[model samples]
Target: MSFLTVIASASLLAATGSDSIPRPAPSGPLVAPVALAVPFRAPVDTTKRARKAVTYSDGYYKRVAIHQALSWAMLPLFATSYVSGDQLLDKGDDAPDWAQTMHPIAATGSAVLFGANAVTGTWNLWEGRKDPNGRKRRLLHSALFIAASGGFAYAGSIADQAEENGAIRERHRNVAIASMSASTASWLIMLIGN
Candidate 1:
C-alpha cells in the first residue's frame, strides 16, 4: 500500500478501536498513573469576552472610517482653493471678496485635513498595538497624506505671500492652483487606499 494509505489506515484503526480498559501488568515494571487533560477552556466570564471582541472590531472600523472621512472632508477645501486661485489670477482685483477670503480658508483647511489624518492614523496604530502590518500600512498612509498636505499648504502660502507682495500676477497663480489640485488629489487617494 502507499505510505499515505498505510498511515491513514493506521489512524482509522486507532480511532475506531474500543475504549475498553487495558489489560494490567503484562510485565514487571511499575509506572506512575498518567492523566489526560482537556485542550479547550471554558471561560469563567463569557460576557466579558464577547464585549471585548466587539470592542476590537469596533476599533478597527473606527480607524478605517475616520480615514475615509478625512478623505471626503478634503474635497471641498481643494475645490474652493482651485476656484478661488483661478478667479484671483484671471480676474485680478475684480475677483469677489468671497473668493479672496477662500485663498486663506482653503489653505487652512488643507492643513487641518492633513494634520487630522496623520494624527488619527498614528493614534489608530498606537491604540491597536498588536497588528504590525496594520500599523505599517497606516504609517505609509499618514506619510503620504502629510506630504501632500504640506505641499499644498506651502505652495498656497507662497502664492498668498506673493499675492500680498503683488508678485502673484498671472502665470504664477496658475502654478499654485495646479500644485494645490495635485496635492489634494494625492491626499485623497492615499486616504482612500488606506
Candidate 2:
C-alpha cells in the first residue's frame, strides 16, 4: 500500500476503535513515535458526537429542531397543569381557592401546548412525506407521538367531567397512565429504531 494510504487506514481503524489490529506493549520507553503521532490525528466528524460543535444534518434534524422547540413550550405547561389538576382532583370543591383558580388556567396552558406540539409533529410528518431523505422510523415516530398526544387529550377531557376522587377521575388517571407508557415506548422506538 502507498504511504498515505497506510497512514489513513491506521487512522480510520483507530477512529473506529477497531481491535482487530494488535499493538506491541510499551515497556518504560520514551517514544518519539508517540510524540510524532499528534500531526497524524484522525479527522473526526464532530457533528456525530457534538450537536453544538458543528451544525447541519439532513431533513430529519429539521424535524428534531421543531420537536425541541415544542418540548420547551410544552413540558412546563404539562407539568403545571398536571400538578394543579391532581390537587384539584384530590380536594374537590373543597380545594384551596387558588388551586381551583389555577387548575383551569394551567389546563388551558397545557391544551395550548398540546396543540402546538401536535401541529409541529404533523408538519414534520408532512415534510417527511415530501422529502426523499425521510426515514420510515421518523415517520413512525411522529405518528406515534400524535397518537400519544391524542390519548392524553382524551384523558384530560374525561377528567373535566369527572367528580373529584370519583370513578371518572380514576378512568382519566388510568388513561393518562397508559398514554405515558405509550409515549415512553414511542421515544425508545424512535431513538433506537431511527
Candidate 3:
C-alpha cells in the first residue's frame, strides 16, 4: 500500500522470484520480504592437474642413514690411526708392538670406511643432483671428501717407501693427517648444517 513498501517488494521479487514474495495477512499490516545477502564466489576450475614427483630412489633415506653412521664411525677410526701413526713416526721400526700392529690395521679400517662412504655418497649425490635444497653444501662436501680420498691414496702409495726413509714417513704422516682433517671438515659441515 505504501510507496517504500511497494518499492521494497518489487526489489525483493526481482532479486529472488515471484513465488518468494511475502503474502499480506488479512488482519495485520503488510510486511516486505527481507532479501538475504549472499557472499560472492568465483567459479571453480575443475580440470585435473599433475603434481611433480620426487626423483630419488626408495633406498635414498636408507643410504643417508648409512652414510651418517659411517661418518660418525670415521672419527674413532681417524683417532686410532693418528695415535698409532704418531707413535710409529716417533719411534720408527722400534715403535711399541701395539703401535706397530695397530697403525696398519687402523689405516686399513679407515680406507675401507672411506671406500664404502665414497660409493654410497657418490651414488646419493648423483640421485639428488636435481634437488635444489642444500645443493651447494652437498657439492662442497663431495669435493672435500674426494680431495681427502686422493690424499689417502697418495699416502697409501708411499707406505712401502715410508718404512725405510724417515723423511718419507713424516711426509706420509702429514698427508694422512691433512686428509683426515679435510674429511672431518666435510663431516662437520653436513652434521652442523642439518
Q: Pick the candidate with the highest TM-score.
A: 3
Better by TM-score, candidate 2 or 1: 2
lDDT by residue (tens digit), candidate 2, 29-127: 433334334455555864344323333337657666776665556456556656766776787777778777776776666567667666766666665
Candidate 2, superposed: residue stretches over 4 Å from native = 1-66, 130-134, 184-194
What is the number of residue pairs that collide in model 3? 0
Q: Which stretches of candidate 1 lie over 4 Å from their true place?
A: 1-60, 125-140, 165-194
lDDT (C-alpha, whole model) for all candidates: 0.64, 0.64, 0.89
List clashing residue pairs in candidate 2.
Answer: none
Against the true structure, what is each candidate's TM-score? 0.52, 0.54, 0.72
Model 1 CA lDDT for position 78: 70
Compared with the true structure, what per-residue lDDT tens digits does model 3 show for residues 55-164? 77779888998899999999999999999989888888788999999889989998999999998998899888877777889999999999999999999999999999
Candidate 3 lDDT (Cα, 0 to 1): 0.89
Which lDDT tens digits does candidate 1 get at residues 1-194? Answer: 34455455557668879545343333444444458877977678763333232135676677768876876877787788778877877677899999989977886787777777667766775666665444555565556555655555556557646665555545355555565565566555555655
Report the error of model 2 at residue 148, Å. 1.8
Model 3 worst lDDT run, 10 consecutive residues? 46-55
Instruction: Give the candidate order by descending lDDT.
Output: 3, 2, 1
